[model samples]
Target: MNIKFSPVPVEDRERGRNGNCYNPGSPLTEGMKKQFMEEIKPICIEMERKYGVPAAFLGGQAVNESGFGLTRTGYFANNFCGLKFVGAWGRKPPQIMNGQDFGVETYQLIGQPDEAWDGSVRIIENLGEDRLIFDESSRYDNRYFKFKSKPEFFDFLCRITYLNGSEGRLYPKDLRYIFDEYRQNIQRGMSIRESCSLVACQLGKSGYCHTEEGNGTPPQRRCNYYSRVITEAMDEWNTYEWTKIALTQN
Candidate 1:
């Protein structure tokens, strides 16, 4: 008998809220917990479908240090891994903003006169537009912290962050456990279909496109490959086409 695939999607548990593992002093909240799982899970899945870093691992790390994202500094800094800034022009880093800025820009769809324009400008101005505002915000840091290649990143996450019932060495053994778990789940006929359409829909809804280096180079062709994933996935799911053109102009 063929076992049916269940795309019920196992959401990562919120450590601070659901498990109560986080300290009471932790800022972890029920609302943020809900948002994190609801929002990040799909993102993780899309990333995993393309990059192979198990969604669980990314979710686990965010839950681990950030108290499921309740840490004030974590929330403010977007420093999900507690990764430090080692780069220099070398001197003791200033305490005022010594973290990676996620560079989360804000905007509004309203025409001409708008409140968001002022808000967005004020935020950029207040921060002095220095860039390097947070540790995880930098694509360079994100690439460094994550695996060198997408495959390496996937393997590393499985070992270092995810997996149940272990917490000693953060590599090799940890990765082994996580990989085994993935195998077990897969053998059980887990849905391995890689569809980027859902990701495209989400990203489209949010009105953003991620560039290869985040240097604002008009999004590379390879990066736009994600759009293909979305298109194909949508075609498979409901026989619908997201874009009228076969592919966007290069």
Candidate 2:
């Protein structure tokens, strides 16, 4: 879901013309943190074990992206990271998908042998077979990934983040670059806080908080707000006793 629709002026986007809210100010509450951590921490740890990504950072991202299952897509689509459907699934695309603004094209996933698909985004991989489908709107368009369970969603995120080659860097704005940085940080055995900070700062430079054609803060500032929020979320998620328990096992 790498679509950046700047149809209107960047001013309009910041002023809420498109109805996209970038900041919510409020951090996760204790009860909210506790409940959410209970739901996602285990999955985050699982993804960490499988991918070497920090559970805390990944969980923080889920909290930031999905708003703890509060957003429409979060609750309905179960799409935590805005993973869009860029191709079809199994067979040719259905005609209904083309009725919208424009025709929906099916494509073969990168690194997969079968190739071009319609319906939902699917690729043969070790993460898991299930993929999430997002057919409601085209904002983060592309069949988007769907999952049967929440853990699967988290796992998909980790796997996709770590995908090699050209297509693997689709999500998270700058995954290829980010993964490289994280890989370095992981090899160094940086603490969760340090790793997440590295992620935030690097992504900020990638226009995480940019506006206008190029009229926005520097990379440091652009990504600062979300980076701060994400890092804070990790702490909030950590305070939960259950989250502590799960992380201990990790």
**Highest lDDT model number:** 2
Taking the tens digit of each residue's C-alpha lDDT, what string does model 1 give over 86-152?
2211222232123235322211111111111213221211122222122222122212132232333
Candidate number of the best TM-score: 2
The whole-model C-alpha lDDT of candidate 1 against the native structure comes to 0.33
Q: 16 in model 1: Cα distance from truth in Å? A: 22
Per-prediction backbone clash count = 12, 16
Give a tens-digit lDDT track for model 2, residues 135-201.
2332222344555668766766666544432434434443566756775775687765776667766
